[model samples]
Target: MGSSSLRVYGGVAGNDRKAERRAQLIEAGLELLGTGDGEQGVTVRGVCKRSGLTARYFYESFADRDELAVAVFDHVVSGIATATLEAVDSAPAGTRAKVRAGLATIVRTVAEDPRRGRLLFSPALSSTVLAHRRVESTRMFARLLGGQVREHYGIGGSTALDLMTEFLVGGLAQALTSWLNGVLDLSEEGLVEHCLEMFLAVQGGRLEPGDGAAGLQAGTG
Candidate 1:
């Protein structure tokens, strides 16, 4: 019984170590991928070096650098989504306040971590896997936006609502990318305020329907 228990404990320790190493590799990938040094920096050797692990350990967690990149991208996206949701939920009970809180969280998150912004927005850094993941993330956010529209306003599901949500998500992504790249020329506060205005307009029924403006107005108004 003692020998059996020892083996079980050893196995559990081994598994824990493996999980820790895997998490380390993923963090290294994020560091490399989010760098201004660009995609060229995101090599197996570079990630392993950044992770303080050898090449052999890299293979234990990932088949190749691309797999690691995809994993990092997913990790970053999940973090952003969680932050946004938490901000909105914690805000005072008002549509405008919730919108402001949610938008501010997203802007601040990317602003504080420019690498994260690059990972989400940089065309030069995109891979096939990352691109596919981006689309999936956008669709997921759109669905959430649709639900918010329904709840915040008395609107039901419709094609117009779907399109409006998609448009809002896409436009926000582009806006953030431009802001991150220094093309938008706005301070973080300015950016959040600007986005809030558009969101408020939508909620207030300023945009027209089927055309992408209509549903937002109905939902928010």
Candidate 2:
């Protein structure tokens, strides 16, 4: 809050340098948390080393490893959420169209960089700090889903909407985790199509079973 924090050195503002260092630290944290077994294996020294910064710089950015882990988690989640929201908003009106657009964004975003997926759902990274961040992201996504359904259906709040969003969010986390880990055995588009068809059968209009499966088989065959 003082001019000292705003002071410039070597043509770079102090605040700018601090932000760059913070970003570097967050990226370092992401690498550690995403690749390691869990937070137990992560250390401040490890992150500092990875970022090529010293302990003082690490302390300037994060209080501890836990805070860094949460920051890393949030960085990934915010990116995916922003891109998906843009895709969904730009898509044609209607639940199926909007959700399919959003689904493609989410799938492609993670598939392009699977470290993002592992950081989000891999059991290996489920430390207390990340677990809480995971819950927050889940609920946040649930709210987004619920808001979408409401917009598409022109309906008010309801318990059914809340339950459906929770179901969709949980199901997505599990399904995408499997896909990312190779357990789902579906290509990126196949996974997106499958989810678009199966995940919202509760809407109950034209989402017959095998809708996506038939398409997937044909595309693969």
lDDT of each: 0.82, 0.83
Question: Which candidate comes out best when scored by lDDT?
Answer: 2
For candidate 1, write residues 113-213 as lDDT tens digits.
Answer: 88889888899787788889889989998998888767666556777678878988999999999888889999999999999999777555543223343
The parts of candidate 1 lying over 4 Å away from their true place are: 1-12, 205-221
TM-scores, one per candidate = 0.84, 0.88
Distance from true location, Cα of 39 in model 1, Å: 3.2
* Residue 96 in model 2: lDDT: 78
Q: Best by TM-score, which number? A: 2
Per-residue error at 166 for model 2, in Å? 0.6
Candidate 2 residue runs with Cα over 4 Å from true position: 1-5, 206-221
The lDDT, on a scale of 0 to 1, for candidate 2 is 0.83
How many backbone clashes are present in model 1? Answer: 6
